[model samples]
Target: MQLKNAALYLLSLSLLALAGAITYFAASLRDINSSLPQIIDTVEKVNQNIAPLVAEAADIKKQIPAILKESEQIRVSINETIKEAEKLNSQLPVALTESKNWRILVPIIVKEAELARETLNSGIQEINLVRQEIPVSITRVESLITESRNIGKETSEGAVAGVFSGALRAPFELIAGIGNSVFSIFKSEEIILDNSDKEMILETVQALINASEFGKTTAWKNPATTRSGEITLVNATTIKKARCFNFLFKFNDQKPHSENVSTILCETEQGSLEVVR
Candidate 1:
C-alpha cells in the first residue's frame, strides 16, 4: 500500500507542473500578439505622415515655372519704369530754358515794337498834310502868270506908242516886274516841293528799314518758346505725342508793322506813299 501511494503522489506532482507551464506559455503568446499589432499600427501612422510631406514637396516643384514667370514680369516692369523716368529727366533743361524766355523777354519786346510803330504813324500824318497843301500853291501861281501875259498882249503899241510912253511905260514896267517876281517865287517853291517830297520819301524808307531790322533782330534774339518740352518714352507700352510752341503774335512779314502803320502807309513796302509825295 505504501509503494502504490508514492507512485500516485509523483504522478500528481507531474500533472501540476504541466498545468503551470501551459498557463505561462498561453500568457506569453497573448502578450507577443498584442505587441505585434501595436508595432504595425505605429508603422502605418508613420507612412501616413510621410505621404503628405512627399506630396507637398512635389507640388512646390510644379509651381516653380509660374513663380519664375512672375519674377521675370516684375523685372520687365521695373525696367520700363526706369526708362520712363530717364526720358522725363532728359527734358528738364529744355523746359527750364523755355520758361525763362517766355516770362521775361517776349512780352517786353512786343510792347517796345508797338510803341515805335505808334510814333512812326504820327509822323506820317504830318507829312501827308504838308504834301496836300503843295499842289494848291502851285495852281494859284500858274493862274496869276497867265492873267499877266493876257493883259500885256491886249494893250497894243500902235494905238498908244507916244501917248503911253512915260507914265504908261512905268506902269507896264512895274506890272512886268511884279509878274517876273511872281514867276521866280513859283520856280523857287516848285524846287522846294520836289526837295520836300524826296526828303519825306527817304524818311519813310528809313522807318521801314528800321522796322524790318528790328523784326529780324527780335526773331533771332528771342525765339519761339515752349513752357514744357517734348518727352519721348522708349518702352513698349509708351505712347508718343507732339507739342506746339507759344507765340504772342504770328510774326508774319506780310502783316503791317502795327495797326497804326497800316493806316498811314498805302503799301507795306519801303518809300511807299499814298499821293505823289
Candidate 2:
C-alpha cells in the first residue's frame, strides 16, 4: 500500500507539472494567435511592393532595344557633324576672299546703276523735246514753202506782162506818125471792131506829141477819116496837181459834129510819164 501511495504521488506530481506546461503553452499559443493579423498585413504589403518592382523591371527590359538604337543614331550624327566641320575649315579661306571681293564691287555697281538711270532720263527728255518741236518746225517749213510759191507766182505774172508790153511797142511806133494827123477819121458807123485796137490807135496819136512841147504848145491836130474837118487836142496842162489833156473833135459824121473829151494823167516832176492819161 505504501508503494502504491508513493507511485500515485509521483504520478500526481508529473500530471501537475504537465498541466502547468500545457497552461504556459496554451498562453503562448493565444499570444501567437493575437499577432497573426499584423504579420499577415506586413506580408501582404511586402508582396504589393515586390509586384510593382517586378512589373517595372519587365517594362525596362522591353525598352532596351529602342534605347540602344537611339544611342547608335546619336553617335552617327556626331561623326557626320565632325566631318562637315572639317570640310568647312578647308574652304574657309576661299569663301572669305570671295566675300571681300563682293564687298569691294558693291559701291561700283551702285554708282553704275545711278549713272545709267540719269542717262536714260536725259535721253527721254531729249526725245520729248524733239517730239514737241517737230510739229512746230514742220508748220514753219510749210509756211516758208507757201510764201516762196506765192512769190514765184507773182514774179511769173509780172514777167508775162512785161513781155506783152514789149511786143506791142514796135507795131505802135509804125502807126504813130499817121495817127497823129488822121486819128479822128472814123465815125460811129465805121469798122471799129476791137476795144484794144481803139486804145492802140489813140495811144499812137498821143505819142506823136513830143514831151518837149508840153508848156510851149498844148495843141494837137490830126486828119480825119471820111471827114472834112480835123481832130484837135488842146488844154495840155497840169490841173488838180495832175497832168490832163482836153480834146476837141469836129468832123463830118453824117453831118458836121463836135465832141469834147478830157483825160487825167500823172507824171514825175521831171516830166517823165508815170501814169497814162
Candidate 3:
C-alpha cells in the first residue's frame, strides 16, 4: 500500500509542471497578439512616406534632361559673359581716359558758354545802334561824292594862262569821283582814296605847280590805317622857263627801305597834265 501512494505523488508533480509551462506559453502568445496592431500601423506609416519619396524621385528623373539642357545653356552663358568681361576690360582704360578728358573740359566749356552769352547780348545792342547810324552816314557820303564830282569838273577845266596856252580842259572825273578824296597837292598829308567797287586806288594827278608856291613835302595814307608815308620834293625845276618840270623826291613809309625818285610832269600844248616818267 505504501509503494502505491509514492507513485501517485510523483504523477501529481509531473502534471503540475506541465500545466505551468502551458500557462506561461499562453501569456507570451497573448502579449505578442496585443503588440501586432501597433507594429502594423508603424509599417503602414513607413509605406505611406516612402511612396511619395518614390514618386518624387521618378519625377526628378523625368526633369533631368531639361535640367541638363539648362545647365549647358548656363555654362555657355558663363563663357560668353567671361568673353564680354575680357573685352570690356581691354576697352575700359581708353573709355576712362576719354571720360577724364571730358571732365577736364567741363569747366572751360561752361566758361565759354557764359562768355558767348554775354557777347551775343552786347552784339545785339551794338547792331541796333549801327542800323540807326548807317542810313545817315550813307546820305552824307552820297552828298560828299556829288560835291567831289563838281570839284573835279571845275579843277580839270581850270586853265593856267602862262604855262597852258592851248589847254583844253580834260575831265579827270573818274579818278576824282571814285576815291572822293580832295587831295590838295600842296597839303602835308592825304589819305589814299580806295574804290571798293573796283578794288583800285584812286591816285590824284594834277598839273605841276610852281615849285616855290607849293610845299616841298606831302604825306599819303590809307583811310583805315595810321601807317603813312611822307615824300619830300628836293628839286622841282629841271630847266629855266621849261614846259616840263622834273621833281626829285625822297619817300619813307615806316619800313627800313626808302626811295629817291625823279618824277617828270609835262604841261601839254592842249594844257592837260601829263606824267612823263
Q: Which model scores highest in TM-score?
A: 3
Q: Least lDDT summed over 10 consecutive residues: which range in candidate 2? A: 163-172
Query: For residue 235, what is the lDDT in candidate 3?
Result: 29
lDDT of 2 by residue, 153-205 (tens): 55445543332233222212223333323343344454332434444445533
- Candidate 3, TM-score vs. the true structure? 0.37
Candidate 1: where is the Cα deviation over 4 Å? Answer: 1-46, 96-277
Q: What TM-score does prediction 2 earn?
A: 0.34
Worst 10 residues of 1 by lDDT: 230-239
1 or 2: which has the higher TM-score?
2
- Residue-level lDDT of model 3, residues 109-169, one tens digit each, is 9999999999999999999999999999677556545544443354433332222222112
> Which sections of candidate 2 miss by over 4 Å?
1-39, 130-277
Candidate lDDT values, in order: 0.44, 0.55, 0.55
Each model's Cα RMSD: 30.6, 29.2, 16.3
For 31-65, candidate 1 gives per-residue lDDT tens digits of 99989989999999999999999999999999999
Tell me which of candidates 1 and 3 scores higher on TM-score. Answer: 3
Off by over 4 Å in 3: 1-30, 124-277
